[model samples]
Target chain A: MNELFQKVLAENSILLFCYLIGSITFILGLKMLSHPASARKGNLVAAAGMLIAILATIFLYRTENMSHLGNYAWIFGGLLVGGVIGTLAAKKVQMTAMPEMVSLFNGTGGACAMLISMVEFNKIMEHHPEEMHRGHLLIIVLGAVIGTVSFAGSMIAWGKLAGKIKDKTIPGAQIINFLLFAGIIGLSIALVAGFATTLPVFYAILTLAAIYGILFVMPIGGADMPVVISLLNSFTGVAAAFGGFLYDNPVMLTGGILVGSAGTILTILMCNAMNRSLKNVLLGSFGGAKPGAAGAAKEGGGTYKEISMNDTATLMAYASKVLIIPGYGLAVAQAQHTCHELEKVLEEKGVEVAYGIHPVAGRMPGHMNVLLAEADVLYEKLLEMEDANDQMSSTNVVLILGANDVVNPAAKDDPSSPIYGMPILEVEKAEHVIVNKRSMKPGYAGIENELFFRPKTSMLFGDAKKVLQELVTELKQM
Target chain B: MFQEFAAFFITNYRLITIVILSIFLGIEVISRVPSVLHTPLMSGANAIHGVVIIGAIIVMGSAEPNDFVALILGFLAVVLGTLNVVGGFVVTDRMLEMFGKKKPKK
Candidate 1:
């Protein structure tokens, strides 16, 4: 019986069957992930499929010599250590820190792809120097370059998001990036075509790719991070796909391709949400400089009005309908919970309160929704941009909470504005617009919001959390 | 170059077919997803690429006992890949947990 089991494990066909099953589960899991109802279970299903694939590979793999795989200790030990660290980090991370954490995790995946390419390349050089095929070599070089870039780029993005690294655009930065990219491609071709088959040349390609990755992300401003992260996510996927090509592994190919396409589609979706093309995002260092200085100076419509906290609380308390627009500032101030408290208080006063979520609000795609969800805001009450805009005119009070660019009328009225033509929440359509901000500073786009100067708008200046807390208290008294 | 690619494709037609089909399937499945689920779904897709851990294991298990470079790289690759898989899914699940049972008791 033991011999029969070993025989079954020795067959490559059974492993292929397992891989096919894993691939199918990944597709099904991703299919279920499109909706909120089954998203958690969908993640589990994909994870279970990954586990099956891992176990099957451990027991069933055999080489050309029909030698079964060895070194059980290293394999299981590595997995155990990684699994524990990953779980703890994921569990410990706060929702506000999620974007940075995701970048860190994605970077690790990129590193893994690069390392796998290196290991496989080393294997070829050591054991089968004469068996080099251009196709195989190309996969190796492509995987190494792309994986390294993804890893390095993600680390920079993670640093930027975590506030550890400031955006730096060196002089002639664009020229330097272009040349490095050219050099990487040139070196990659040399290695792939056997012009330089030495490991040193291969390593040079990776080094150049890594530098290119760092430079690629270094100049991008905060507003473009969602697009940058999404693009890197796709690069990592493509790198993993090359790994699958190297091994002829269906599960890897399917998962990699799925991620690749998903990331690509998402990158496009985010760019559309910002009313910018992918090319425009890459070339334009948006939110990096105060280019908005000119735009703001030109749009100096008038001085803005300020409302007292007591009056602000009374205004919302008396309003029949209130629409709250939350933004990246809200996330930075950790005011989602307090904002939700205000929402609930207003609701109890027989006032209608619903959140208007801009697709590109906060620091990431869907960032505002996640923060609100963490505060136990009902999903139904969170309206997308279009939905919120449709209801804007009927809204008695539009409360802009630590949000700016998404609500700026400049996006609609000023064609010369940097964010012009970008879809914004039509808070100006509401009967009254009350904005909660820390100060008169411009938003991430560095442009002064024209809405602030509108006659219907009143700025309530304070920290979002403190102000919301005070408003909640004031409402309770009424 | 064309001949090389032709030979490669002939040998890898099945895998190539799988790759092509999966790309379309991926785009189709999530084409209409609400923007609210973007972050979780992106993180979920990120975790799925951790399947490269299988390749890492293969390199580790198949290397000669004396090949320190291969073994070390493979070990690190496995560890990082595992982290991508485990952390990605776990974090994605946590995010989705909040989205569960939308009828908030509060």
Candidate 2:
């Protein structure tokens, strides 16, 4: 149409194209990630797209200026500071914290969204403070509100994972959350009505968002955090996408959509790990077994027969099929490699060894898998809850190696318990069950494992690593 | 890099889509037949995040007349990329730390 407009479009075409490509990469990469085998490639292709998108945007923006070398200097300084911190953190953070780190990154994205929206708002205010079109102004205000809330909310989620925020109910949490929501909404409405400006009400809304974030997450126990973390991550993405709308940026919209959808899907998966519906995860207090439930009531009554390492090794060495159910106990004792050593010794004796991993065995999803993977256990040797359970009943010996809640038969038998309907590894259903544990302190849910007292169940008391070591030594003699 | 392909990319996005889909699916289908070929999915993702460092480089290098908005975005990009780099290595370290550990008495 117009020559100048055409020139502007042409000048920025590469950025626009890069944004589109990055969006496509994000979409296809996530789809390919459905299967664990191709997930890495999917991640790579998507990351390439992200790099292209950001660089294109930055380069296009830089073309508008050429004389301010000091401005370039500041950008350089930011790079150096960020590069050192980010690289060092990534190099040092544990795999278990991957999900948390993801949350933190998502929070940072939200921060960008908030900062950009604020900058734009300030620019508009400085330029045309008196010419507020109520409708357009409303859009910007709404974007700022959503973006700011998402930023603070995601930050709170990150804090929870970083140990900056502790999980304890700050008395009257629900009442306070309700008040904050009402106050923020009222303030937002007042701003739109031209009765107030962000100068006063903005900070007030921010305080509410911060409190809401704290109150929202502090009530959720550590066990149910994955779902919460993923949910907040998606919130951050949505916030960024909204900020894009405020700036009229097509690339931001597309990238944000991909992140939002993928993050939401991850949240759903995390919920399923806990056998929880999205609604339940948000509104219900799930995970810990309620008092006087089956695990607690039967705690003192069940006859938990004990076994020595030698006897445990004898059974494992001779058994035709041995299923090892590993849990947080294994992680707590860091016995994964020793377990692998024991498995190898059994394999040498012509015994089949497979590890049974429950969906929510440890504090987070895939906790046991990472531990076992570090032990250099073959990926094929690890069976998911469904796969491992199908074969458990046919196995000769089911070794409950330091797992607690995952292999507990009480979960299957007790309907009144909190984790009642959650899917669990059927190590309890195996022909012979041998439990390794240090004490009967109950699991994180405070539930006694009925698998311990089953007629076939016998406790082998020792640290997971030491017990596995002793078992390996005994199996070597066999 | 693909200025010549721009026309094809604009007109036939399907061709690029098909090529990428085939490569990824090919690797995936191959893995299913042999479980030992478990794809290094996490490591691959780590590498992708690593590519952000290159993006950071570009952003830092190309800020000619330095748009404040672009500068801010670039600064954030570097931080994000570095976190991934350091965190990935740290996880590898801690995982390595877990090897050969024995369980204490239950």
**Candidate 1 true-interface contact recovery:** 0.78
Best by TM-score: 1
Cα error, candidate 2, residue B97 (Å) = 18
Top candidate, metric DockQ: 1
Model 2, span B1-68: residue lDDT tens: 14433543564454334334533442343232211111122222332223334334344445334356
Question: Which whole-number lDDT from 0 to 100 does residue A199 have in model 2?
Answer: 59
Give the per-residue lDDT of model 2 (tens digit) for A1-478.
4986666677567666776686577556655544454444565566567657655655554333431123546555655675577666655665545546655654544454544445445555655867665544555565556555655665666777666777665666668878988887888778766788655576576567667766677766655666676566556555555544444455445444444555565566666666678876665344323444544466466577888777887877779999988876786677878888988899999999898878666545666766687678877778887888799788999888777776666567788655677788876567788888888666756566666777888888888888888888888887
- Chain B TM-score, structure 1: 0.89
DockQ of candidate 2 against the true complex: 0.10
Q: After superposition, how far is residue A375 of candidate 2 from its true place, in Å?
A: 2.6
Compared with the true structure, what per-residue lDDT tens digits does model 1 show for residues A137-215? 8898898888999999999999999999997868888899999999998988888777888889888888999999998
Off by over 4 Å in 1: A1-11, A292-301, B1-5, B103-106
Per-candidate Cα RMSD to the true structure, in Å, reads 2.3, 8.4
Pairs with steric clashes in candidate 1: none
